[model samples]
Target: MAQQETDERVSDEFIDDTKDSAEREQAHRERGTVRPITVVGHPMLHRECRDVTAFDEALASLIDDMFASQRAAEGVGLAANQIGVDLKVFVYDCPDDDGVRHVGAVCNPVLDELPPDGRVLDDNNEGCLSVPGAYAELPRPDYAVVRGQDATGRPVTVRGTGYFARCLQHETDHLYGHLYLERLSKRERKKALTMMAENTPRYETVPNAE
Candidate 1:
């Protein structure tokens, strides 16, 4: 009977802790403002992000701003460089084929420290908000092991396969001055460029009669 009472007390405490945390996070979101999304031609998107040292209030505030911007833009992932910040961090929330949700943010992510023994696959429709109206076929390892921190500075190591792995690698690549289009094959690159050119509008003038 005593053991049962102890378990009940522990469960109650856990619930209270979770509720408090959620409330605090919501309040933080309310207090923070979202940053603007940077486009492809921006120099920051092509530059590597710096490692985060001293995860203090500034880092926490940046993460909150990123989350807000991501939600506002409705993107699956966003990097710090995407918003002109040079911090090595990104957010992701992708849905599976069956509509299940997997969402999280990773700060100072390190990837592929392990051997790339996993199979590589082609995802032909990768798109980035920064690269507007652009889609390319990028080759990616179907599985990867990533290590990083969560929003609250807790260490997290995740081993993912399939689309989840693709998302992880894609965001991590953004931190390192790489875009998915850079991973396309030579033929695919030509095709993508042609497509981009065709989509671009050219100003033309009508011939005048003498």
Candidate 2:
């Protein structure tokens, strides 16, 4: 659902195009990079991501690929695992309820403190890039302010209110071992699973992590 090609890859094997990580970075910087999305049920989707220790070219390239993929899929945000990387990073270009755009990436993020009154998801429902074709009324804080380092190890903060808030929560959850489905109640979870079964398998075939 996301990406797997350097905008200039213009050929098959975009995912296999790189001989190594350095080449991948070069390809990404030259143009947009789109990595194939890791579908639901992929082991990485259920595991906590590793912290990003190296604020280097590789990290920046990965972020670029994420943005390219998110745009290709027409998604609002994307996390590392969603594209088969297990690093704590995510990118977004989501809009608030007022249509103001918010775009950037964050690594090793910590969500802001919620309002003392607690919070809930918007009535519009929520979805995930990994769990394609499925969405449910998942409750999450209605606002968010995430803080972390950028790919270059620079301090960064992202704030959101309204739908952008949901995007922040959703992407952060991906860095953990949680998907939107896990946010649903037992009954709702069952319903969502059934709906996905009636559609194309998120991954044409299940992925093996080990």
Candidate 3:
């Protein structure tokens, strides 16, 4: 898969040791615009999110909030459940390996394919805002196509390859209450559990607090 174009860091308050670490940290501190990302063990993260059946002002507002929350958390994409909503909705501003931008909001999404059923990854590890401080080698298709509606109920189909594809599938999994950890082998799952057990909360509120 191609690399993802992201400036948003997954971990909360990470000190980027790049050339402008100080500048980046200062900006993040000033922004303070993040939403509470949900973590594993939250009941909502274990249940399938409901399909978005209502397209109204509330839906629009929710999408906006998710966008804000996602940017605040420095994420490439985010699902409604990630912010603690039960609706099957997600938003993204990610990129393909070639650095082309692909962005959108998808509600009530259906995947065109799934892992163990498509092209697989062996070397790449995936992270979750929900499963903070944990990284696991979870295989997913290198390409992804997701079909759903926009906030206004207009039909939308999105196709992505590389990191963008991975973003789509990851957010879709959140809609179904499936963490990347679920895709891990038993040994990896055990290690992820250990990581979660040793970590602290990433945000002030539960991811589902909304």
State which candidate has the highest TM-score.
2
Worst 10 residues of 1 by lDDT: 8-17
Query: Model 3 shows how many backbone clashes?
Result: 2
RMSD to truth, every model: 12.0, 10.9, 10.0
Tens digits of per-residue lDDT for model 1, 137-168: 67677776666665655565555566666777
Kindly list the per-residue Cα lDDT of model 2 for residues 1-120, writing each as its tens digit: 112133321222211111353443334435666667777678898889998878897887788888778867668889988888889898777778887666677788777667777766
Clashing pairs in 1: none
| Comparison by TM-score, 2 against 3, better one | 2
Best model number under lDDT:
2
Flag regions of model 1 displaced more than 4 Å.
1-31, 113-117, 120-122, 190-210
Global Cα lDDT for candidate 1: 0.64
C-alpha local distance difference test of each model:
0.64, 0.72, 0.72
How accurate locally is residue 174 in candidate 1, as Cα lDDT from 0 to 100? 89
Candidate 2's TM-score:
0.79
Error of 1 at 116 (Å): 4.8
Alpha-carbon TM-score of each model against the true structure: 0.71, 0.79, 0.77
